[model samples]
Target: MSVSGDKIRHRYDRLAPWFDSLEGFLEGLIFRRLRKRLWAQVQGEHVLEVGVGTGKNFAFYPDRARMTAIDFSPKMLEQAKRKRERKQLDVHLDLMDVQSLAYADNSFDTVIASFVFCSVPQPRKGLKEIYRVLKPGGQLLLLEHVLSSNKMMAKLMNLLNPLMVRLVGANINRQTVKNVQACPFKSILVDPTSSDMIKLIRAVK
Candidate 1:
């Protein structure tokens, strides 16, 4: 069976045209605290956002900073470009993969991701690439839905994730903290529960 990642990507590609509607529906339903936390990390020189769905975090990026964003699906990237064009924001957008990126090592000052880790095929390889692409002391910021501490919820997630991922590129339960810890980056963890259901992490290479 093909992994859920491609299916999820395809789902997003199909949904790209109505993405803003989905974003509108998900606005208040999304993670605010983690969003703010990760946004604050967007203040550096060269900011790289992976899985930058529709350029949602572009506004939070420091106005003076250069922004480069990538996604696996061209359809998603197209919507993202349209969004950027509407905003008149000069953002570099591309169709790229997280696990194997084209950027050279130590190229970016800050690497950012939001709501994206769960679908990546090889999480460790992605992290290694993230580490390699970031300059020393450069930070990695992430805001994501993660596995819950509640055992019952965790159990349910373990069972239903495969099916849920089939319909969307994201899973309800990804242990992003464990993945961060295993990466070379020095991780700082913050778990804030409100509406967003997120894991806010800032790690340095």
Candidate 2:
């Protein structure tokens, strides 16, 4: 892992135990519905979930699809494992970094990421890895928070980004949609699901 990756791991390790509590109110009010809707749109037999924090999306994954989920932080992976057992979800979990995935090329039919790129030190590297592991004609499904398109909101996010990263290991000002567009995917569908800040992206590999 890179130095930044190490820092992220440490921060999230410390945050892991209470991460769900931190997002509970927001998840109950909004993100839970968005996650379900996003997960429902995925269509594939084999799925790989990158940054599968706390396995919150585990409940929404289709039973027909085989699933593998990974995160770089060990503590987060531990929490995710607990979630998997508690929910009785048949998911394989890994302590893996997105920028250096262990899977073979063209290994999976689908890849899912939720609110992940913002914290990755090298977001494009991670995206490229996701693209490489996906089978031809496979899909990359994402539910992400990105830099707002509105100027004032964008400025505010930019200002708060550093503190957000330092405190919670997440950046609030990433232009993840643009990063996805710049990747080598064959096709892209990008939609702002919430005020041009949160987005749902589907990219064909």
Each candidate structure's TM-score, on Cα atoms with residue i matched to residue i, is 0.90, 0.96
CA RMSD, predictions in order:
2.3, 1.8
Which clashing pairs does model 1 show? 8-169, 31-196
lDDT of 1 by residue, 1-205 (tens): 1374576678889888887676675665655444766687565689899998877776676788888999998898987888888889978998999988999998999999988888786777888899999998898887778888889888888889888777776677777778888887765555444333467777878
In the range 59-174, model 2's lDDT, one tens digit per residue, is: 88889999999999999999999888889889999999999999999999989989999889999999999999999999999999888888998888888888888887888888
Pairs that clash in candidate 2: none
Alpha-carbon runs more than 4 Å astray in model 1:
1-5, 191-197
Residue 106's lDDT in candidate 1: 89
